[model samples]
Target: MDQAREDWSPHSAHWGAFSARWNGATLDIRPYEEDPAPSSILQNFTTAMRHKARILRPMVRKAWLDRSARSERTFDQKFVACPWDEVLDLLANELSRIRTEYGAAAVYGGSYGWSSAGRFHHAQSQVHRFLNMAFGGYVRSVNSYSAGASAVILPHVLGGYEDVSRRNVTWDQVAEHTDTVLAFGGMALKNSDVASGGISRHIERDAMQKAARRGAVFYGIAPLRDDLPEEAGARWLPIRVGTDVALMLALAHTLLVENLWDSAFVARYCTGFDIFERYLLGRDDNTPKDAAWAAGITGIPAATIVDLARRLPRGRTLITVSHSLQRAQYGEQPVWMGAVLAAMLGQIGLPGGGYNYALGALGHTGRRFNAVPIPTLSQGKNGTSEFIPVARVADMLLNPGESFEYNGRSMRYPDIKLVYWAGGNPFHHHQDINRLRRAFNVPQTIVVHESAWTPMAKFADIVLPATMTLERDDIGAAGTDPRLIAMRRAMDPVGEARDDFDIFAALSRRLGVEQAFTEGRDTRQWLAHLYEPTRKALAEAGCDAPDFEEFWERGELALPSAPDDGGFLRAFRNDPLNNKLPTPSGKIEIYSKAIAGFGYDDCPPHPAWLPSTEPPDARRPLMLIANQPATRLHSQLDFGAYSQSKKIAGREPVRLNPVDAARRGIADGDIVRLFNDRGACLAAAAITDDVMPGVVQLSTGAWYDPEPGAAEHPLCVHGNPNVLTRDIGTSRIAQGCCGQVTVVECEKYTGALPAIHAFDPPEQD
Candidate 1:
């Protein structure tokens, strides 16, 4: 039997597919991956065991007794573990049935987070590849919240695949070279990926202390703390979130009005200058409203706004955190406006003068790998469009939508009877958590593929076990490093578990398309097929990494990176027009001709603000947002002890301003219910001045903790923040997710609410 499918002996999470639910059925199990001629088996054993111990370490000191209070997937919970064969058969049958009734379009593919860092065994990569090979394919949406804004708006702004390109200058240029920085969101080196890992505020304080000793001046404009070093002596011009464009436009108008504009640089490079000046800068009778008008919207004093704009230094200037623009009703405007502000100074396209997404640029400095393209294979007639871009789930699921075109087919998701989820955990990433749980309940079925159980998997009809990165053979680039580390199966399965690749490959075979995938080949043989292109590339590069097998056994192979250049400043300058940007016009599209072609008038040609979904309502006065945790990435493997150990004690805390909390009669450490029209989160309040007033922020990625009797375990009921976030505003600029806006009202946390268990098979119910 193929190694990929041979692991499905008997007892496995896959059994849920067979009987609608696992009902205590059992079967034969085997050592999924047996290593022969074990070289350094002990070395590998210790490494793997250490990680395994680390993952389970929390369990030793774990207070499962109380974790049980919020726990959805407890051993004591009445569950019926069943056989893998039955589960696989049922899933195959149901999938086939769904396809027959609704077509391939009836299926939805959902993914979140990199399940494992391993290259080959990544749940997302395999899932996408398999989905394409199975059903024609589903609409796909990918990215994290921290960078989603960049991924979405940059292409529209830069007029290309925004991920390409490198900075012509470095951070040193921003520090030593630039004069005035129109800091957008004010997130500095610490919160950003620029520091490699995030920098600590204490470390940031030291950098600021050093820069301040030199007597530098910084005018910080952000809704939150300006990440400027204190030693540089910073002035905070705290602006309202999402009102950045208005302030920027006002500043641009001021610059143009005072005749302070850079005429020379404007003449050197930049097209459409006249139109921008006329419409945005406001000349003649249109005498644009000055900084005061912007101040009203942004909450910065008009005089202060003007003074800061005028005070900018003469040399290269930078605009950081342009993502603030996306926080409002009209999100793109601020980003575009920031660029317009740079253009007004004739500073853009100059060294350290413009804006770049924090790590937005992907510079492949080396010669492009010249590997031949893999033959385009059909995703065997699997199933159809029951799949919407999971980012659009709030749009497709919550609100009934008029049929929309997807994957060349027009469809709606109302008929979606079963949802097969793998790879991503929408619970952690989506906005408006409380609302998502309800919307999720509306679906007839929800199944998840997981190694360590998560909220999504708990609510699933079938919880398929998966292999961890350390326990599976996978391949991937080191990204920064030159070596390719082959992930070897280190530890044995905890119980009834199989690698995701094995689970899906077998499921695909049972669905009648096995030949297209494995063709009955073993896992190693199939891996060789996948690695062929990589092998060729390594050979071409004269890599001295051992033969693929030896490399696999030893587990590391370094690859070369291309050279570096001042990619930031001189990108596409040679042929801006023909520079192959993904837009209709390849150059930096100050005007998005492609979006205009798509007929999304709201998006328009320029980056403009559209009202966010969370328009202020009388019922809910506070705006809500979700932020990421430092320890975890989105919602992968939360069961590990290291992560759970990091959880805030007492209750999940919602960090809000003390002023706002005081007004609402809430206090520090006080249990609060963060309620919106969509749903409510129960957490203690951390009323600190660190957060700006009027906005409530939660570190999402908490394991869903269901109300005491929630029909679905709230733990199982991972809140889809998307419920509070609307999807219809922005066009499909790139992927489906849009910037989020939500309203919040705080109330004292009233202990466990209710438990909601999902439906069992109709027979069991």
Candidate 2:
């Protein structure tokens, strides 16, 4: 018989349609007709589906099973295969013991973002639901790695997180009305390609193309040229690292001095501007934030800075700030200052105007779609509410009783005995891998549900093999996206792997809460249950939607597009009093009194120029930027052929300026060692002027592979940038990660290179 072809969508933000050709036992995937140009993310679907690193069965760490032979070699340890019943029983017993002894607060649910895009199989929601139902509850986390700073600070400044995600002006509006788009940190095209929960239409690239065609002049204010799209005709301004806030302040100051400040707008819809103006001038501080001062700090010419500031008010403008700016020291400033600058331009609610925290950072930004909230597995109210900032996993593990300030509240870290992780990988997201590894050893028991033998899985006490999205039936709909795609099971589960729902259901049965967990429904029944609401929503919107059975058979449903509203902030701008923001002032808080009440010295009331905490030692003058990878989604398919093809000499590629390369006697393709006070990593040098001098670009998400016990500088064989990144928080107020605050010295490696073992499985005794 001919192979059965089934339509399905993978778990990504740039949701491309695909046809899975199933030949009895195996599956072959190809892009559907709708996906005009399949990206590298689409090409690697098969490789991710059939990688060698996939975990086949339940694995128990030998050291944990045999108490007598405990070794410190966590990464090098062997795993012994165990049956599903035994593993489930062991997990249930341990969880019960922990609850009985240490209480439910001792169990930490360590699931981050980057799981299956399917609404049904969302790993974080599923795990939380299971824990909430079976056990009392688990300590959870807030915010995400992408925009942790904005998640906390934006609420004080612009009312809520929606100002960044839902309220930002659409690209279509920009193309139609805006004349200039100044992208600070630039439009990260690669980062925007993939999103969580699956993308129905990958129109970000096309959106940029349209905007460019409509005569919107794009200017990239970043250290690298490749940060912006080549097709957008972006004029690059190689700004110095960690100096964006200084540049923004100078622009604001210039606007004030040149009589270009929107006094009427500020007087009507802003607060604490007088105090900010004093600081911008030389009244509060001895030094003025003038064009000259900004030029010295940002490396951009004074003329350029003044010209840009003046030009912004002449036409419809949008200041696009990437999330990376806030992943550094004083991370909140850039986000805050970007808004202040936009407010000063008096175009906060105008079409193609205002500040965008993440314009093209993800797939769903600024898309005109219906506001239907996708239903997720209900995580019942927790008996105990103990949580930490998302990026502080290592801190929580290491410091049990330590108190830290977060969003104007003092939060104490709970002593966690059991860590139940599913879906997300903390090893990839958390900084300072070596420190995190040490912290990982503190938990009494660590359980992980993973498809592949990632670093997180290898370190777990019990590793439960979970099926990938391809091997499961699911429904995918991104936030506010009109299209709903069916994720049909392409093939049977690999080996003894199971879906998260099945695994959690079986565990719930052992825990005596099986009915509560499953709600008297199997996988198929649950999928149909979830689809009913969506069908109802489509019908209400006057769009034809098939029944559950018909929808399952058809495989995809595209809802009619919603009418394009002017700008996301149009309602608020039209009537400030009636459609008031949820903030205390009911207007834009340029200087947040709420934040000031927190008394955080690092993060002040207003955006201020604070030098980064990099060592001033001349030997380590270069600033290392650990950016997002272009090949794969945060260590997801690093072993795939598409991702592997980007590897230079079996190591991550590090981009360096020609001047820096010449100064260090390093050439393109040369094996280089990047070192600082924290740790060392290896990478193949790519000599180019794409990066500014005294700066280097090493994309993060490389699987961390450290040499066993070389104390002085344990070699990171796989070029993971986390080896050198700081694990400190952005500020005492926000308490987000300062992952980008890294300074390192790079030189050509002249020693024998260590074999890359991060991709390979551990040896079995």
Candidate 3:
């Protein structure tokens, strides 16, 4: 018979379709007709699927079985393969024992955002549902790494998190109405290239092009010039790291002093301006937040700051603050200050004239689409109500029963004995690898459901082989994307690997909860059940969509278009009192009284400048910034061909200014050691003026590979920047991660470079 051709979409924000050419057992993927030229991220899907690092069979760590073995030596231990039935039985028994010995609250479900895009097979949901059914419950995590601070703080300032995600002005509105776009952290093109579920079209680049064509000025205030596209004609403003809040305060001061602020709008629509004004004009503090004061802190010219402040209220201006700013100490200030600046401009509800916390961070920033909710596996209820911040995994593991403040609530970490991780890799996401490694050894047992042998897999007591997206049938739809694409099983599962749904279901059967877990529906039936709602919504909107059988065969269901709304906050702007927000005052809280009552000096009532944590030595003054890699989604495809191509000297590339490099006697392609009090890491230096003099950029997501005997200051052989980053909360109020705070000194490495072993799987004895 002729080879079967099927359509599929990979998990990404710039999601594209592909045609699978399968000849019985072998499969090949090509770009579909709709997306002729697929994105780089999409093109590497097959390479990742067929990579050597793929976990082909279920394995168990020898240390976990041997009572005498040390858990700290997990990296050196070998794995042995086991049958599915045997592994499931072992997992079920251990789970039951843990519950009986301690409690269901002792089980920590470590699943995170980076999982299968298919709503049904989403690892977080699948694991949560199984745990809820079989066991009493599991300790869950709150918020996400993308915008953890914004997720918690935005609701108190604005109405809720939807204002940041769904209520931003669309790009078309910005193009037509806005004259100047001030991007604080710059547009992260690489990070925007992919999404969670799937993307039918990549509109970010086109939207920027459109705005540029319409004569909108783009000002990128970041260390790197390439933060925004060259085509956008963005004027690069190099400001000092962690000094954004200082600059914003200065701008507000200038506006207030020059009588450029919207006093009428402030009186009518905002609260707490008097308190903020007192601080701004030196009434509270003897030091006025003037242009000169900001210049001293931000390293920007006083005249330029004054000029920008004057120009902001001239035309329709939009101020965008990247989530990266809030990943530092006192992180909430910049986000709050950005809003205060926008409110001063009298553009909170105007089309293209407000503060956008995450504009181009994701590709679907301000796009309009049908509000079709994807059906998720029902996680009935948590019998045990215990949780922690997502970034507090290490803290929870290390210091159980420790009290911490988050969003005006005091919570204590549960004493966890078993860690059941499904999708996410904490080794890549968490800060301070050495601390996390220590915490990893504290748990009695660690279970991981992974497709590849990630660093987390190496540390696992039981490693369950799971199928990749390409090896399973799934349904995908990103939040802002209008198309629902079918993800067909292009090839058979590699070795004995199975889908997460099957693994959870089989485990559920072993635990005597199969019916509860599966709800009497197999994978195919589940997919059909999930699609029914979308099918009905499409039909009601006068859009043609086939049934499950035909949709699976054809491979996509596009939602019907609706007339564009003016902007996200248009309705609120049109009518304020009647359409009041969820806030206490029903107006923007420039100075939140509730937050003031929280009594967190770290986060004041209004935006204010707070110094970042200082380094031990003032001489070693470079601030190291660990950003997201352009080539991979976190650490998902670090082993892929495309991601590997970006590596410098077979190591993670660190960008530094030429002046700084010359001062340190570092040349391009030279191996450099970035070290501080926390930890150290080795990276290949790439000398360029793209970064500021006092700042160095090393993208995160490199797998953590520590040197064997280097315990004092454990050196990460693989260029994982988290090894050198500080693990602290943004503030007492939000308690988000301060992953961006690190001061380091870089020097040329003279020692022999270690071979990168992060990509290789552990030996099987």
Candidate with best lDDT: 2
Give candidates' CA RMSD values in order: 9.9, 2.1, 2.3
C-alpha lDDT of residue 520 in model 3? 94
What digit string (tens of lDDT, one per residue) describes model 1 on residues 12-59? 010000001111221122211221111111121222222321211011
What is candidate 3's lDDT per residue for 622-731, written digit by digit as tens? 88888888877788878877788888877999999999899889999999999887788899999888888888999988888878673756688888999888788888
Winner by lDDT between candidate 3 and candidate 2: 2
Residue 40 alpha-carbon offset, candidate 1, angstroms: 29
Looking at model 1, report the run of 10 residues with the lowest lDDT sum: 11-20
TM-score of 3: 0.96
In candidate 3, position 696 carries an lDDT of: 92
The predicted structure with the larger TM-score, 1 or 2, is 2
CA-lDDT, candidates in order: 0.50, 0.82, 0.81
Candidate 1: Cα lDDT at 613: 48
- Candidate 3 residue pairs in clash (backbone atoms < 3 Å): 12-195, 13-194, 13-195, 15-199
Question: By how many angstroms RMSD does model 3 differ from the true structure?
Answer: 2.3
What residue pairs clash in candidate 2, if any at all?
Answer: 13-195, 15-199, 117-197
The alpha-carbon deviation from the true structure for residue 257 of candidate 3, after best TM-score superposition, in angstroms, is 1.0
